[model samples]
Target: MKYLLNSNNNILNKLKTKNTLLAFDLDGTLSPLVDDPSNAYIPDTTKCLLAKINKFKKYKVAIITGRSIASTKKILGELPLTIIGNHGLESFYAKIEEKEKWKKRCLILSSNLKDIFDQNEFFIENKKYSVSVHFIKKNRSNSTIKKLANTIKPLLVKNEAIILGKNVVNILPSNKSNKGFALKQIMKKYNLHQALFVGDDNTDESIFEIKKKDIIKIKIGMSRNSSATFYLKNQKEINSLLKLLNDVQTQGINFLCMNMD
Candidate 1:
């Protein structure tokens, strides 16, 4: 993948004005990656830039996250950005029937998982619309993944999906509930001409794998396996990117005075 900061010219040339969706993943993209998800919060510097970017009328700013809507809402209080939660299973516009369906599924999975895995082995997060099975000990993550994958298979519904994140396992519905599917829905809903999405893990690969030219997929941490074409080196660079984007979106992209190394 190419370094997004270095390719200022290409990045500037590709970005458009109105009907452009500027989206981000929450943890490890907008917020620092912490051992505990609850501790993850948007840095004041990054939050300010995001708030400004959201105010730009031409672009649609959104948070497409694996985070549950309720939890994300609590963290992003009064942000006023479009939020696609539970990897798209829970949203502001989702049908009531759909929400109830996932809620039921989560409860069952939570109960079933609790029977087999210990609190130390798996820190289960039942988000109503989804379930995340996390490892309590960082050193045991790789081994824990093998155990998690095997243990969850029989307990899961045929259509349910199991996705691995940064040392975490996410269980949710597979029926058009991935971030790619969510992004497509938003693209259609908003009639967006193009999009710029930034994410940091396998969970975000769904958006990166979208075979479309209009959507610019940027990975927060560079990986050769990642389908994203551009990326920031790490989460620390997120604020810089957001600041640059805010400058572009608010004042319009300037080729001459804006290129940063």
Candidate 2:
């Protein structure tokens, strides 16, 4: 409940223990944010680190984001870990296929809403399978956002869609979709005693606020008086962090085996 801000490597210390779950946001954290989100992919270093983590069955890796499950898989290419998508409205494990289908079907109405807005000439900007109406470029002014919200609110409500106001305005189906909810579900599913969340956007603050002592929050990119425990400047720093985690895991295992022998 109380907020804590920590340094860059504080969370890494927690991961020194075995059985840590590393959950990451897709865009702007694992992958750089681009004009188009769909094309975004994690850098080779990040991907390699993830594959290494997957080797230890005690540790679990999950990707939590606003993209659809199939879309997330499409971008990631090879899905070895669990994923929660459409914010937490959808969750898919490596073994389960039915839940993934159900979540996608539940979002079918969202596709219709997308078409409706497209017909109305509402400039859809953050279309990486996650649609957002960005008023940020039109001068980051509150009035611009307010005008767009006023125009779109009633239409979205009528269609059973909800507006998620972040750096931009996003209209999506009224599902309990958000990173906080998604993280909780993943934590429970994995029985995660200690975890770490790394993200770069305001939407990520939601999860950071709910974190327990073992679940530390990390912010990548601009630092602010946020719920994040630490901050990093760019993707390079994030890659470095992942590599550090991998090396720590490798060394710990070797130490344990030597002691046992």
Candidate 3:
């Protein structure tokens, strides 16, 4: 994988192509990962770049996150961009009353989880289609998450899955509706051929592991384990990417893009 902020490997030129989509994962990509998940927010510098990127006529900007749209909206602050939430489920878009049959099972799981964890210690967020059990590093013992998983595993029925994410445990109604699947759906709807996705954590891996060559995947943190083609050094380095994108649009590609090592 190449270092995104370190070198210009013609990746920006590829992104400038027609029918492109620029997408991000919120928590560790756009916003700093805080001890309390609810307090996470995109910094002013990053948010400003994202807003500018959204206005660019060449690409469609989107935020695909694990947070529910309701929660994402609270932190997103009214950016007129495409937002897909709950890893891929939200808004009850279907017409059939029978379509959301899994909600009842998820609700039961959510309720049962309450008995297993302390509300103060664990942040149990019920996103209707998924349930996330988050524990901060300082509060978590080695066996805490594992024991919790062991207990929850027994309760999982058909169509349910357990995903181990960064400092959190996620129970999804179905693993099929991930960021990669959601990104493809939007691409199909908009007829976008080129795409860029920036994310951190296991949930974002689906997007990184896509088989397409046109899709530029950048994992927030550099890791050989990830299938991403490039990576920004860390979450803080994301500003360099956003800045380059903004400059590419406003300052002309040749003038803004300087020689890189």
- Candidate whose lDDT is highest: 1
> Which should have the higher TM-score, number 1 or number 3?
1
**TM-score for model 1?**
0.92
Give a tens-digit lDDT track for model 2, residues 126-238: 33234556542433555666676676666543333434443356654443456877787777777877788888766688788884877767787656557776666565577
Residue-wise C-alpha lDDT for candidate 3, range 1-261, written one tens digit per residue: 888765446577656647689999999999988888889999988888888888888889989988888889999897887888877765333223522765666688788888877887777778866889887454455377677777778878876778667768888877567888888888887889989999987789899999999898999888878889998778887887887887766664554334221
Q: Model 1, 86-192: lDDT tens per residue?
A: 99988756789978888988988888888888987679999889999888766455566767777788877788888887778889955557898888888889989
How many angstroms is residue 240 displaced in model 3 relative to the true structure, after the best TM-score fit? Answer: 1.3
Q: Note the residue pairs that clash in candidate 3.
A: none
Better of 1 and 2 by TM-score: 1
Give per-model TM-scores: 0.92, 0.74, 0.89
Q: Alpha-carbon error at 103 in model 1, in Å?
A: 0.8
Candidate lDDT values, in order = 0.82, 0.63, 0.79
Worst 10 residues of 1 by lDDT: 252-261
**How far does residue 172 in candidate 3 sit from its true spot (Å)?**
1.0
Q: Cα miss at 22, model 1 (Å)?
A: 0.7
Look at candidate 2 and give me any clashing residue pairs. 6-229
How would the candidate models be sorted by lDDT, starting from the highest?
1, 3, 2
Q: How far is candidate 1 from the true structure (C-alpha RMSD, Å)?
A: 2.4
